[model samples]
Target: MFAPTFNLNLTLRRAVLAALLAAGSSVAMADPLHYHVEIDTSQFSGAGFLDFAFLAGNSPAPGATATLSQFSGAFGALDSKEGNVSGSAPGTLVFGNGGGYNDWFQNVSLGGRFAFDIVFGGDFLGTNGNVGTTFSLGLLDQSASAYLGNPNGNLLQFDLMPLNGALPASIAASTYASIASISAVPEASEWMMLTGGLALIGFALRRRRVAALTA
Candidate 1:
């Protein structure tokens, strides 16, 4: 009878093309996130050299200014004997000079550490669906009017969201502490499209069991 309806329409079109290749390999498997920013300063007594600026806002609301241009240029040049301080924009970070000694707080000893790498998906956490979304970190010193006031004490703020199910990796800011690490590998072309969709549904069920054993 038409070869049993052409083998049941070729096994329902190879099981609907293996469920659309496993739903496009789970939407191209995207999960990569690593961010670390540590600036403890060992209790920071502050003697000279304290210019910290790392601002990023998406409306957590607490003086949300918003300026995180994908970590701008990724902190390239700034070698105060390799202590580092050269950030005009792009999540700047400059806490005390290294060795240059400019006069406006560059005497050294402000504490260290600054690392950056981001990939949180969803257009970088815009949260269109709105399960959760909020990122705010504003710490400003920039010499605070030459230290007449606000001497790098009461300004450091952080309001990163995402809990329980996990997101807000880590952040501790009195002087500085931000650690966000998330890695969910599956790249290699999504494992070759999930092994070529299970080898095309195992070659279409072994060619429909050899065409039903030669009918």
Candidate 2:
């Protein structure tokens, strides 16, 4: 006599639950930290080539800063300009830093003008100087373009001058360095949602199976 096959639905249920739990355990809203870089040149190319690194457990909060090793460009020169820095819109398909932060690090349209705000704790120009330059970085325009990949948004651009009207003494030095190194941890809520969804699916499936058997 031939043996009967065992039910396969139970195994499927367990596998689905496991996957949902895994996904749910890793959901957290990324906190955003902003760092602005001043572009030195009127126009340049390959600004995105700068090496970026992020460490784990870094808070996306104010007073947190990132240190860049160096700034290099494809044109063999530090093709950056001086301008006040803040961050772009976070978590967007266009002009976003791939992760959960809002920095204008990607998809910049050259020769286009935009405005931004910068908040400094003290004198960014120097420690001894008291040139309280606290205002919006006005006329913040992309004076030039460099690359042609990832559409018009992925192109990078910068300011022709730090403040536009006049050059600040801090133009030579970067007001904000590239904090390319940071990381974010997942929150507990994600896991709960995933588990909850899986449980509901399992219950519905089991009920259907029972109904079928009775019918």
Model 1: residue 40 alpha-carbon error in angstroms: 37
The TM-score, computed over Cα atoms with residue i paired to residue i, of candidate 2 is 0.23
Candidate 2 residues lying further than 4 Å off, grouped into runs, are 1-48, 51-145, 148-188
Give the per-residue lDDT of model 1 (tens digit) for 1-215: 22464765676587667657654553322222323333333343343343333333333312111122233211333223222224333444332212222111223333233233322322323222212223223222334344312333432333332232334322232322332222233546656766776776676777767767777
In candidate 1, stretches whose alpha carbon ends up further than 4 angstroms from where it belongs are 5-16, 19-25, 28-55, 61-193, 196-198, 205-209, 212-215
lDDT of each: 0.36, 0.30
Q: Looking at model 2, which ten-residue stretch has the lowest summed lDDT?
A: 130-139
**TM-scores for every candidate against the unseen true structure:** 0.27, 0.23
Give the winner by TM-score: 1
Clashing pairs in 1: 49-96, 49-105
lDDT of 2 by residue, 29-101 (tens): 1121122433332343222322112111222211212322222222222223222223222211112112333
- Number of clashes recorded per candidate: 2, 21
